[model samples]
Target: MRQTRRIAETPPPEECDPRVEALVNDLIGRVADKWTMIVLEVLAQRGELRFTQLFRLVRGVSQKMLTQTLRHMERDGMVTRTVHPVVPPRVEYRLTDLGASLGAAFCGVWIWAEDNLTRVEDARARFDDRQT
Candidate 1:
C-alpha cells in the first residue's frame, strides 16, 4: 500500500520549487497584513456580519480600508460577500472554508506570540541595554 502525504507536510527548503516559494511568500505577505488578520479573526469568531457590524467590530479600520480589505479577501477566495435584494440592499460578509482553514493555521502563530511576549520584551530590553 502507498502512503499519502498531507498538505501541511511541505518539502524541505532545498527541495522546494523557486516559483512555489515565491508564490507562498507573496501570499503570506498579503494574508498576514494586520487588517487582513483582524478581519479574518472577526469573521471567524462572529460567523457572518453586515458591513456596519464588521466596521464596528474591526476598530481602527477606515471605511475605505475595510472595503479594500474585504475585496482583497474575496478575490483571494478567503471570504464570500452576498447582497440581499431588499429595499436597503443588505450586504453581508463571511469567511469561506478556506478562510477558516487559514485562521486555524494562524492559531499556532498567535499562541507562539502570546507565549513569548515577555521573552520578546526582555530581548528588546537587553538589546537596548547593550546599545546604551
Candidate 2:
C-alpha cells in the first residue's frame, strides 16, 4: 500500500467538535456588522460616551439603529453599559479589552482606507470613463 503525503497530512474532521464550529459561526455572525464596528471604534477611542453623545459622534446613524448596535455589542461582551440615575437618567458606554483589540485591528483598515481614498476615487473614475 502506498501512503500519499496528502492522505498523511489530512486531519480528520472529528478533531473539531460541532459545538466549537457553532461558536465560530456565531462569532462571525456578530463581528460582520459595520454598525458594530463603528460603535466599537467610537467607544475604544473616546473611553466612555453617553448614548446620545455616541448618536451624534457617529454621523448618519439613526437613534434606533444605534441603540440596536449598542445592545448587540453589550450582548457580545464587547461593550459595557452603565445606567446612572440623574435628572434625566444617563447611560454610558465603554469598550472591553476584547472590543478595544477589535477596534485596533479595524483602525488599521480605516487608516488604509483614508490614505488610499484618493487612489480609489481615481480608479473609480477611470472605470467609469471606460464604461462610458
Candidate 3:
C-alpha cells in the first residue's frame, strides 16, 4: 500500500464521515457568500459593531440580507450577539474566537489574491478577447 504525503491533499472520502462531509459542504456554501466574507472582514477589523454600523460598513448589503447573514453567523458560533438593556434595545455583534481564527486563515487568501491579481487580470483579458 502507498500513502500520499502531500501537504495540501484533501482526505480520501472513505476516511471522512458522511455527516462531517455534508457539514463541510454546508459550511462552504455559507462562508462563500460575499456578504459573509465582508461581514467577517469588517468584524475582524472593527472589533465590535452595532447593527447600524455593520449595515453602513458593509455597503450594498440590504438590512434584511445583513440580518440573515448575521443570524447565520451567530448560529455557527462565529459571532456573538449582545443586546443591551437600553432605550431602543441596542444590539451589538462581535466575532467569537472561532471567527477571528477563520479571519486569520483567510488572510492567506487575501495575500494570494494580491500576489496573483495581475496574472488573473491578464488571464481574464485573454479569455475575453478570445470570446469576442
Looking at model 1, which ten-residue stretch has the lowest summed lDDT?
4-13
Instruction: Point out where model 1 deviates above 4 Å.
Output: 1-19
What would you estimate as the lDDT of candidate 1? 0.92
Q: State TM-scores per candidate.
A: 0.84, 0.71, 0.89
lDDT of 1 by residue, 40-77 (tens): 99999999999999999999999999999999999989
lDDT (Cα, tens digit) per residue for candidate 3, span 27-100: 77888898999999999999999999999999999999999999999999999999999998999999999988
Candidate 3 residue pairs in clash (backbone atoms < 3 Å)? none
Rank ordering of all candidates by TM-score, starting from the highest: 3, 1, 2
Residue 35 Cα positional deviation in candidate 2, in Å, after optimal superposition: 2.6
Once superposed on the true structure, which residue ranges of model 3 sit more than 4 Å away at CA? Answer: 1-13
